[model samples]
Target: MIFPCILSGGIGSRLWPLSRKDRPKQFLPLFGGESLFQKTAKRVNHSGFSAPIVIGSNDHRFLIGEQLSELGITANSILLEPMGRNTAPPALMAALIAEESDPDALVLLLPSDHLIRKEEVFLEAVRGAEQAARDGAIVTFGIKPSEPNTGYGYIKVVPGEEPVRRVDTFVEKPDLARAESFLKDGGYFWNAGIFLYSAKTMIEAFKTHQPALYEGLLAVMETRHSDLDFTRLDADLFGKLENISIDYAVMEKAENVACAPVAPEWDDLGSWSAIWTVLDKDEDGNSSLGDSRFLGSRNCLAYADQGLVSVIGLEDVMVIATSDSVLVAHKDKAQDVKHVVDQLKSEGRDEVDRHPRAYKPWGY
Candidate 1:
């Protein structure tokens, strides 16, 4: 059985006003009244996959449970991290947990916030990579880039016609020139951060490449306690474990790494501009959520949380208005929203953390 291990520990600060520390983008109902987390969970709820294992922040434990219950889906385990420790630890932790049941079980490590428009294509790619994973290859799904997007990392796959190709090297986010060059050069794929590997294989990879992290997590797992339906890790031990990504800790260092190049119309929606692209637009290229109206606006996005938002004579601009905060910026500068979030953080602003109306288990 392939265990889908969904990672949901991102703040998504770039999508602020709508996405906040208390309730990040993954939990927000952005797509047809469903959050990205719910979509991800539904994607793997079919026959080929087992009950998902969610690894997320302890602060969002209630959010995770509530969302899953809303969909009538129950997770195999909801592992809570006291604090953020990046992807490496959770990757190994999932492997360790799955290994307890079946050492050779395949674990599909997925990020919960990504949007995969073509689920069939993505699942077919997963099915194709299953044999490679069972053969002891740590398969990373790489998206075939439709454009020279500098926002994402790149994976260089060796020339092959096979379903799974040997990964040449992993490249960090590049400048525009380098990104374009990668587009011109064939065999380059966007590092989608998706992986499929045997539980035992990943555990051995961690033991070999990240021994300290492996040992530390082993100790942390030994003392893990259940909090209702959630699995809580020892805060002290987990915090002490190295804060590193799986790419840095294992994928970049392992020889068994492989790439499954696919095009499932994937997007991470990392920024407001990204969100604008995915949203339904009108004749004037204006998109809005809630009671919003546009006049002479082209390629503009306006989100109104509480009241009606009206835009006039604007092109390529975005307005995100909540009850407490309002943000207006050019679509070209959408990525810089994180800087605004940083500035708010520096000022110790409450807006940096949550909206005026907070969501809780009982009531908002």
Candidate 2:
């Protein structure tokens, strides 16, 4: 069986105002009233996959439960992390939990905040990589690059006729010139961070490549306790584990790493501009979420949480207005929104943390 493990521990500060510490972008109802998390859960809700295992922040336990309850989909286990420890630990933790039931069970590790337009294509790619995964290869789904996007990391794969190809190397985010060069080279793909591997395969990878972290996670799991519907790991033990990504901890070191190149119209939606691209735009290239209008505006996005928002004679500009905060920036400069978030964080502003109307289990 394929056990889908959803990783939902990111702050998503790049999409601030709409996305905050209390409620990140994944939980926000951005896509026609459904959150990215909900979409991710629904994507794997197939007969071929088992009940999902969610690993998210402890602070978002209630939010997670409420969202899952809304969908009427029960998770196999909801593991709560006291604090962020990146992807390496959760990947291994999910493997460990799945290994308890069946050592050879395949685990599909996914990020909750990704936007995949073509779900069927993505699933078909997963199915294609299943055999490679069962054959002891840690198969990562590499999105075929439509553009030379410098926002995401790149994976270099040996081109072949097989469904899964041997990964040559992983490359960090590159500059525009390097990104263009990668596009020119047909062997490069965007590293989407989606992995398919057997539970035992991942556990052994961790044991071999990251023995210290492996031992530490074992200790943390030993003292895990259940809280309501969530499984809580030992805070102290978890906090002490190394803050590293699975790419660094295992994939880069392992010789069995493979890539399944696919084009599913995938985007991480890391910034407001990215959000604008996926949204439905008008003839004038203007997109609005709530009560908003545009006058002679082209390639602009406006999101109004409560009141009316209007943009006049603007080009490539975005306006995000919430009850408490308003942000206006050029579409090209959307990636710099994180710097604004950083400034707010430095001032200890409440806007950086959450909106005025907070979401709770019982009531908002």
Model 2, runs deviating above 4 Å: 360-364
Count of backbone collisions within predicted model 2: 0
- Candidate-wise lDDT, in order: 0.93, 0.92
Per-residue lDDT tens digits of candidate 2, residues 73-186? 999999999999999999999998888877779999999999999999999999999999999999999999988888989999997867899999999999999999999998
TM-score each candidate.
0.97, 0.98
Whole-structure CA lDDT of model 1: 0.93
Give the per-residue lDDT of model 1 (tens digit) for 1-364: 9999999998999999889988999998879888999999999999989899999998899999999998899999999999999999989989988888776799999999999999999999999999999999999999999989889999999998898999999999999999999999978999999999999899999999999999999999998899899999888888899999999999999999999999999999889888888889999989988899999889999999989999999999999999999999999899899999999999999997876787754545
CA error at residue 139 for candidate 2, angstroms? 0.6
- Going through the candidates in order, what is the number of backbone clashes in each? 0, 0
Deviation in Å, model 1, residue 132 alpha carbon: 0.5
lDDT: which candidate is best? 1
Clashing pairs in 2: none
